[model samples]
Target: MSILVTGATGTVGSLVVQRLAQQGAEVKALVRTPAKAALPAGVTAVPGDLTDVASLRRALTSVRTLFLLNAVVPDELTQALVMLNLARDAGVQGIVYLSVIHADLYSNVPHFTGKHSVERMIERFELPATVLRPAYFMQNDLQARGAIEGHGVYPMPLGSAGVAMIDVRDIADIAASELLRRHWAADPLPRLTLDLAGPDALTAASVAALWSEALQREVRPAGDDLESFEQQWAHFAPGWMAYDMRLMMAAIQQHGMKPAEGSVQRLETLLGRPLRRYRDMVRESGQLKLG
Candidate 1:
């Protein structure tokens, strides 16, 4: 049974495809532009758009499982619901969803709201589903690479809040395992909500310190004020995205995005191994540079 992966070119989805291909699973990747998809060898590339039901239906033929991640769009909920309906019609056996942390509690954030809506739809479907809610990704640090190098600073809206940040690769690894596992049939694949994180939690300051140590350069954590950060982002980002980012940052500050106790156990049980920690990612990526 082949596995179909949506968002096949994205950060987490791309890694999921790679891991599945490495495991010898028949992997089919759905991409809007097949030419741009750099999927690994032994994987099928199907040209499709998630918003188009016909394309999705065509991609779902003979696919047993699906890895679902919505594209960044205003109509994400509508597109996801349409895709879920088509998957059900095509007899897809299981679904693994990559969603944001605390999506249910943050309706003010449009992206989280979209994800929550999709999760609710998945719960109501006959198709077994597992939802993986991963905390803030380390990849977000890459967005500030230039600034870090130029000004010795990392500007994030996350204030004094400590978050259990995870690497996208770790998230992908867990997802690929779930998609390839055959043990779900006996238990019917519980509608699980997995909270994924690195081995430890770190505040913005602590993250900068790690980067500094890794790169042997002094790095400063900037943007202690939310309004200033929001205004700066709004100058370049779309209104909706800027607003959502601000709200998400605020939620992180107020509630702290750290994983709950036993989160690491859940991750370990799912992968049958310990999760990768932040330091491992720093060493592997070699993106951290010190002043």
Candidate 2:
């Protein structure tokens, strides 16, 4: 009766592992290198990769619940399909998949399309799973610390449609809760999707203003220039991945990442607490000295 977490060394995956451990769940982390994976003391680290079938089979053995997370790689869809197929064969009781918000709407983006396809497969095959479609991760802004701190600018072209930027910490909390629910349930759970979003639907201009208020310095949005944003990120990420993200930004511009009606309230009711705000997380993250 153990829960297995893939991408255990990664951002959200790592946080989810910590959360499950704090809740005292029997957690197993699937990592490439178990010796090097810096997981909690009691959490078991299993060596496996999505592409390696034998390793995955070994990892899935005796595990009742799974947190399926895959990075935005070239073989993302392939990896997800393979893992899902394997999960089915292994009779894994419950699965929690980390998907993007508006995955069905943003069909142009590679990762989004992959997730949409995965969602359909889950439904078509009737996998006992919960898909968590999270909004723009507020921590993504942390990467722009150089721009915000060094220059007085927020460079992301989050567009005018407004994104309800969600906090990663809250995502982990909800993910762990779902994992625990599925783990402890006597019967198998049905397929469900949760739209994880923040309280405020923030615009680029408003985000700049929030930074200004928090840092006590004038911070400005770099404007919704998709090409420049892509070019700038191209230097850091793969060229195709950067372009993929630019397309995603365009979709966000056209169709905001706002949650469905009462999704935020539903999430709040589930957690028995308000969803974390973008502004408050910034202050607590210790990324910047609050003014």
Candidate achieving the largest TM-score: 2
Candidate 1 lDDT over residue span 181-207, tens digit each: 632364447677788887777777887
* Residue 103 shift from truth in candidate 2, angstroms: 0.4
Worst 10 residues of 2 by lDDT: 282-291
Tens-digit lDDT track for model 2 on 237-257? Answer: 999999999999999989989
- Once fitted onto the true fold, the runs of candidate 1 whose alpha carbons sit more than 4 angstroms away are 182-188, 287-291
Q: What is the TM-score of each candidate against the true structure?
A: 0.92, 0.98
The best candidate in terms of lDDT: 2
lDDT of each: 0.82, 0.92
C-alpha RMSD of each candidate structure in angstroms: 2.3, 1.2
Off by over 4 Å in 2: 287-291
Please report, as a residue range, the 10-residue window in candidate 1 with the lowest summed lDDT.
181-190
